[model samples]
Target: MKFSVFLDLIISGAFVLAAFLWYLASSDNAKTRREKGDDESITKAEIFKSWIIIILLCILGLGYFFSFIGSLSL
Candidate 1:
């Protein structure tokens, strides 16, 4: 049970960090006009990937929380 709680907290922190990173990435200045208009990277897709990862981590944490507590004797 204690282990589950600790894992949950870690996962929560990871989610928070991912959110902050997404916000920071979104808030970056637009590319300069002279830098080339046709080139683009998959930064947004990567951010989305991070979001998915964080969500999965949260789900795993929840599962661990429930399973651990349910199996423990009160």
Candidate 2:
């Protein structure tokens, strides 16, 4: 509820959103590569990398959000 906590969530959400968009782009690239018989696995790897980072960022962001919210409760 505080300004800092809200800002933190916004930043975290930004990172998460970026990662998701990257994943989509990577998926499209992978599809294209597959169609062209290019490096299909590389695209898959990039998607996995982005997804993992997104998940980790979300976990950290949520942890921060909840901690701030918890502080407000007291």
Candidate 3:
């Protein structure tokens, strides 16, 4: 594989990993908030936003990874 293609795969993998970690963090934060009975905690809108970000990141990462796979085949 070319250096650039390898780099792209690495970046895409990073993006996917970041998204997964972000999701886990968000879930843990919500659980902590619930357990603590915090008066001021993450709102529904914030949760929704986080989910959106996670989804977008996954989409971007997968898109790049698949495109690179195709290129490598050529």
Winner by TM-score:
3
Greater lDDT among 1 and 3 belongs to 3
Measured by lDDT, the strongest candidate is: 3
Q: Pairs clashing in candidate 1? A: none
Model 1 lDDT tens row, 3-44: 665665566566556656655554352234224453355554
Worst 10 residues of 1 by lDDT: 29-38
What would you estimate as the lDDT of candidate 1?
0.56
lDDT tens digits, residues 6-73, model 3?
87788899999999999999888877777887655355556788899999999989998997898799
RMSD of 1: 5.3
> What's the lDDT for all of these models?
0.56, 0.71, 0.85
- For model 3 the TM-score comes to 0.83
Identify the superior model by lDDT, candidate 2 or candidate 3: 3
Candidate 2 versus the native: TM-score?
A: 0.63
